[model samples]
Target: MEDLTPDLGDDRTLLLVDDDEPFLRRLARAMEKRGFDVETAETVAAGKAISTARPTAYAVIDLRLGDGNGLDVVETLRAKRPDSRIVVLTGYGAIATAVAAVKIGATDYLSKPADANDIMNALLAKGDALPPPPENPMSADRVRWEHIQRVYELCDRNVSETARRLNMHRRTLQRILAKRSPR
Candidate 1:
């Protein structure tokens, strides 16, 4: 057998896992510019598979993926590379998920729309200078609405199926979908 992996040193390597291809590509480029040799995966399976071979020295994982939640990926990275610094990013910012991500070994949790600077700062911070807290925390209703919208999108905008999957009445799902997104 041969070691097929590239010779990127741990200090210069980064693993970035996210479902959004555009975001993943953009971030990978930005991180590479910052001197890391970036490796990326868009699903939990892919992320886990990468983790199995050689643990990354740094990782930035999305909190939500098309296939599953990102915390599971974070856990795997933590197990594979206990010394790796991990950051979890999400579009759906929720207190519960942030806490969960941290507890699962993420060094930082950032909401989506985060620029490369924000991510880089979080990834590079040396256990000092706390990141600014969200000015407006997401309300429970807003979080619920976002989850419903995500599921609806995942179900290809099928109201009936989205409702069924959510175990909510179709009419209620329709009403929620019809309403404007909560702040």
Candidate 2:
């Protein structure tokens, strides 16, 4: 597919923020190959500092960072550069956080592991047009696992609290959490 590199402005600068070092490096390289001047950060603090110092025209930020929520960086970027196209990414995709990201000025929200193509498309998507559906959407079991994991993270990884909130037995929740996510 042809890249949709939108001419948002003269600034084709992109910021990529994620805690995953290898993923960050790979994405930065990919975006650079696509003609963007990419800057990267591994923590929310670093992301926020870079954003505040120099807000990029585009950004792909992970929802959770080692230091804090990526939403904080998003918020800062939006405040500094209102026209920026910012995409929020998360391995633990959750509706509440997606909505929150959008509410705070994210251009889009995508579940990780979103590819460079997907991230670029999201950043460049024009107007209100919806993105094409994923070729390989997650299975129901995987989705359930992600939801449980999200809730668990939100509850500070307290299995009992997560189970209570989910109205599931603690042991069952434990088993689910223990096992690898279903494909």
Best by lDDT: 2
Task: Residues 1-183, candidate 2: write the lDDT tens digits.
Answer: 886445546788999999999999999988887889899999999999999999999999999898889999999999999999999999877799999999999999999878887888888888898777777777999888888988998899999999999999999998998899899
The TM-score values for the models, in the order shown, are 0.70, 0.77
Every candidate's lDDT: 0.84, 0.90
Where does candidate 1 clash, by residue pair? none
List the candidate 2 regions with Cα displacement exceeding 4 Å: 1-9, 145-183
Tens digit per residue, CA lDDT, model 1, 80-156: 88988899999877899899999889999887767776777787777766766555667888878878888898899
Backbone clash count for every predicted candidate, in the order shown: 0, 0
User: Residue 122's C-alpha lDDT in candidate 2?
Assistant: 88
What is the C-alpha local distance difference test score of candidate 1? 0.84
